[model samples]
Target: MKRTRINKYGIVACAILLSLSKVTLAVDNVTPISIPMVANAQVFADFTDDIPAVLNYFTSSTKDEIIDFYNQSFGESIFQEKNESALR
Candidate 1:
């Protein structure tokens, strides 16, 4: 009996994948052109004072209620609006 030949397509696919991986590694080795954190560096430390106890009242409540209230109120402003559906 004659021996079967290996598939050429599978070998070609593997070679292509290997070459792509090398290109990816070469790109990653380059230094980032600029520092990324400049905009985000000052984001923290906005609240210097102690967090108020009132903030805890929010966490104690059920999640759905809190989510509904939050989505309805557009931040703190919505609490003043009289929407019975949102209250439910």
Candidate 2:
């Protein structure tokens, strides 16, 4: 009986360690991406934990002004009408 209890405890400990390791690996695998924001923009919502993170905000800046800011930030003219003028 004592040996059986010891085996059960060992199995439980191994399971716990395996689960913890999986969580650690998952956290490590999530490479954080930096997103540029418009200056003086009012952020209404931000959901960074989701796959393809989302950010919602409003700015008084004109559409062209916003596009220019992102273009300069990313060092490319990435904002276009085809992508709804959004950075992918």
Q: Evaluated with TM-score, which candidate comes out highest?
A: 2
Q: Give the TM-score comparing model 2 with the true structure, all chains together.
A: 0.56
TM-score: model 1 vs. ground truth: 0.35
Alpha-carbon RMSD, each predicted model:
14.6, 5.3
Off by over 4 Å in 2: 1-17, 24-33, 49-51, 78-88
Collision pairs in model 2: none
Residue 72 C-alpha lDDT in model 2? 85
Q: Write the per-residue lDDT of candidate 1 for residues 4-70, one digit (tens) a residue.
A: 8999999999999999999989867764332122221333323223233112121344645656666
Q: Lowest summed-lDDT stretch of 10 residues in model 2? A: 78-87
**Candidate 1 Cα misplacement greater than 4 A, ranges:** 1-4, 35-88
Model 1 lDDT at residue 43: 35
